[model samples]
Every structure is written in C-alpha cells, then in structure tokens.
Target: MRLTGLPLILLAGALTIATVVATVRWWRRLPIRIAGLLVMEVLLVLEAGLIANRMARFYPSWQALGGTPEVAVVAATTAGRLDASIAAGEAIPWTPPGSGSWGLATTPLVVVPPDYLTCPDRRFPVVIVLTGVTPRPAEGVLSVVLAPTARTNAASLATVPAALSADFRVTDTYAVVAGPGPAQPGLHALRSFDEAVRELPPPLTAPHRLPS
Candidate 1:
C-alpha cells in the first residue's frame, strides 16, 4: 500500500496511543520496548519537521531553475521614450538585438540613453548587454557564435522572470532582449540575473552606512 502523509500521521498517533495504553496496563514491565518506542516516535517527529523545512526551501529554488525557456520582448518605437519611461529609476536594462545573427561581422547593438534624454536628476534604468563567450576577459564581450544564441534564448525565456515574480520580488517593469545561440543564450542571462538578484545586499537604512 502507498504510504501517504495522512496515513503516516494516523499510524504515528495510533502507535503513541498504543504505547500509552501498554505503559498504563504494565507500569514497570517491558521497559526496554517502551523506551525504544518512545525514542522512535521522537525521532520520527524530528525527521518529519526537518523534511518539511527542506521542502519549503527547495520548492522555490527548484521552481526558479525549472520551467519554459522563452524570451519576452517589449518593443518601444523610440529609444528616447523607452529611456524616459522604462529607464527612469535606479534599475538597469539589457538587450540582445542582432546577437543571434549568424555572421562574423554581426555584433550585438547596445544603446544607452543620453543624459539629455531625461532629467539629469532622475536616474535612468541602465540596460547592460552581457556579451556571449569571448576570448577577451572584458565585460560584455561574448564569443561570436555564443552571443547570438544567448540573445535568442533570452528572448525565448522571458517568461521565467515573469512567472518567478509571483513568488519572489521580481521586477515586473524590467525588460530583457534575448538573441540566438547554440542552445539558448538567454538561459545564461537568466542564470546571471538570478545570481545578481540573490546576491544583492539588503538596503542600508542609516545614512552613515551609505558608501562615499
């Protein structure tokens, strides 16, 4: 028979009742058996609690790793409008345009909003393009083949962040542009984003704690 949580709980309760009944009937007899059963019950309860804690933690991590791999594209007619509206804030943006094109000359196009595009006092959302595999160690430089794939994959897997936002503090207003790659380049981007979001330090409340 399949053992389920409810049945196991019932069985454990029954066993506890049986143990109590036996102790009441024979107050000082079979001390070894009674002690052993009590020890077993305590261990069972501890094990169940540990398992429950693990499940609670594991479900979120597993969900972030698993799901549909697709990119989400939010198109803006003009870069200025995108910069003024979406880019307004401390947040950043990243795109993978032309990264999927199959050509040595083809390179991902990156656009940064001009300071004049928006109020100088307002912090615009910075769109960072994570380049594919590249021999160069410089940031944003990706390998020619890998760059396109990554961009494409990013577009395909856009839904992941959308879905994850329901459970976690995912920024719904953010934008991602995925290009193409050998597999899906977006997967790496997603991984990188996940790591970044997870590693972010809690905001410092005291002005003295703020960096100079």
Candidate 2:
C-alpha cells in the first residue's frame, strides 16, 4: 500500500501504540516492546524496499516538465475550456521562461478563473490540479468533476487541467528532495503552480494563495 502524507502519521501513531504496549506492563511479563520494535523495524525495512522497488518504476520514457506531444485536438465540446477570462490566451502552450528545467509537457490543459470576464474584480477560487503520477492530466477532473460543477456553481474557479510536466508527478513516485534553497526541482512542482497563477495577469492573479 502507498505510504504517503497522512498515512505516515498513522504509521507513527501505530508505532507509538506498539511502543506503549511494550512499555506499559499488563500483569506479569514485560511487554514485547523491544521485540515489537525489532519486528517493526524489520517490517519497515521490507516496506522501504518494496516502496523503493515500486517507485523506481515511475521514470517513464516520455519527456516530463518542459514539452508536450501532439494529440488530437480535443473536440471543443469534449476538451477543456478553450478560452476563459482566467486563461491568458486560448490555452497557450505552458513553456516556462528559463531553458534549464525538468520534465516534458503531456496534455493540453487550461488554467482559468471561475468568472474572469464577468467578475473581473472579485477574487475567486483557484484549483491547482496536479495529475497523479500519470503522464497526462486526468480528464475526469477537468471533464467530469470541474466542468459539471463549474457550470452549476458561480464560485469563480481556476483549474490547472492538463499542461503539467511529468516532474510534478509525486504520488507513488520518488520523494521530494527539499534542497537548501527553494530552487530545487522537487519543490518546483508546487511552486510552479504558484508561478502559473502569477501568469494569470491582473485581477485573476490576486488569489494566488486562496483564503481558508
């Protein structure tokens, strides 16, 4: 099973429980804390091995981060939004300003405000979508989740559908190596989301860090 985010905390809690059970005597015999730790450590090592083995497989052959391949133009009906007030232009190719970068582009996703044209001044909601470890953005989020919801709801929404580099893939993938500085590639994935939002220009950019 994937051990990420909250699960790690849960593991710590489980280990704590095991530790308590070992320390706190029940009746006569000492709890198996030492033995439990040894077993748990062994299990942890095995788990690490299994995780490492699985994560090694995520280095997909396709380019990540920078460039995207050509795919059939999603029908205006089926594909993501073509042009919205939130978008800088009609789904411009997402190429960062600098040359030195990681990852290749995968899909043609658009990032737009919920109501850019209608509510130019109002700060609406922004959704920075990071498609799971897969190469392309999950169409379901853009098509199934957001589209239907956006049509019905008036909350100005900005979604990053498609257009993310494979570098952003974190789930079931390698760990984020937080280098000394924020410039690290591993950390760039999320910061890049902020950068993308900054590109929105004018009013749409205000909600870069949306409120709680």
Candidate 3:
C-alpha cells in the first residue's frame, strides 16, 4: 500500500488497537501477555510515526525514503528529449527528471525567454515559482513552475538549478517565489518573495531550517 495518507494512518491505528485488545484478553497467560504488550508498544510507536508522517510529510512515498537518482544526473540523462514543436517563451510540459522522488502527480512546466533561442551562448538565471494551483509563466525570465512540494524543500532545492543546467542554458544563480500554499519554507540560501520577476541575481543568505 502507498505510504503517508489517511488510509495508512488508519491501518496503523487499527493494528495498534487490535494489539492492545489482544494483550488484555490474553492477560491470564504470562507469556502471551508479555509478547502482546511488546507488540502493542511497537504498534503504538509505528502508529505515532505514521501519524506524524501524515502531518509533516517526511516521506511522501517509499521511493523517497530509499532515495532516488540525483536531480542533476537524471536531468542530464533523461531530460534531453524535447519535442520539435516546442518554442521559446512558451511553457513546455516537463516531467522534471528526479520528480519521482518528490511524488508529484502533475508534470511541472518550464518557460524560457524568447531570446533564449537567439542567445545561444548566453546562460540566463532561473526563477522558481511555487504555487498551489496552476502556474502562469512570466516573460523574459526562465521560469520553472513547480508542483506543490516538488523540492520546495531547501535541502533539495540546491539540486534543481543543477538539474535545469543540464538541459537548458541556465546559470547557477536562482531566485524562488512562493505562491499561496503550505509548501512555504526557506529554500536553502535562496529567499522567497511574493513576486520577484525581472529581479536578476538575488542576494544569497544563510540557510534556514524547514520543519521536520
């Protein structure tokens, strides 16, 4: 079964309750009681951990816990296939190579500046736009509209620029803009603004911790 959802939490709770009832019913037998108590404790801990995961979303999926390929590597290898019809300054549907680990249900979108076609040697800075709903790309800048919680995670955010660099001519420097959502957190050294379009080369600051 998939992890980190209401169903999993309910299953864990049910198992814990069953263990507790079994322990009480078998109290007459010393060995059974001891084993039941031990199982109950374990189940209780498991239930709590599951609940916490549901609330905090530490491990969205089994693959995320085991760790997937780095975003840079995946982007370099798999993100090379671009449709012939794709044009500059237009939003392109992107799977975002390493997004499997983030458990994204929808594909992310990327918008490169119109000059990106003519300016072959020029590497443009990137802007990460985080939104809870569908995103509308801005003009002139390389915009990456991320699905909610697609590594808005500061620890994982650093790898994104590197990933984009593999396929697109983008610089290491990037700025983040958080739209309305629960995924709001300090994105590594990158500070998030309500709207930061056309603001080239934002200042880098100390990393901030995200809630676990």
Candidate 3's C-alpha lDDT? 0.64
- Can you write out model 1's per-residue Cα lDDT over 125-197, one digit (the tens) per residue? 2222334422221121111122333234455444433332222222223323223434344343333433333
Instruction: Name the top TM-score candidate.
Output: 3
In candidate 2 the C-alpha lDDT for residue 206 amounts to 27
lDDT per residue for candidate 2 within 153-179, as digits (tens), equals 112221221222221211111111111
TM-score of each: 0.24, 0.21, 0.47
Instruction: Give the least accurate 10-residue stretch of model 1, judged by summed lDDT.
Output: 136-145
The per-prediction CA RMSD against the true structure, in angstroms, equals: 17.7, 23.2, 18.4
Q: For candidate 1, what is the total of clashing residue pairs? A: 29
lDDT of 1: 0.37
For 55-160, candidate 3 gives per-residue lDDT tens digits of: 8889889888898654432122222234234577788777656855554446777876676665554556677776534345444457777775544476655567
| Residue 99 of model 1, lDDT score | 26
Q: List the residue pairs that clash in candidate 2.
A: 64-103, 64-104, 65-103, 65-104, 66-103, 66-104, 67-105, 86-113, 114-156, 114-157
Which structure among the candidates has the greatest lDDT? 3
lDDT, candidate 2, at 157? 21
Q: Residue 94, candidate 1: how far off, in angstroms?
A: 26
Q: Once superposed on the true structure, which residue ranges of model 3 sit more than 4 Å away at CA?
A: 1-85, 132-139, 150-152, 188-194, 201-212
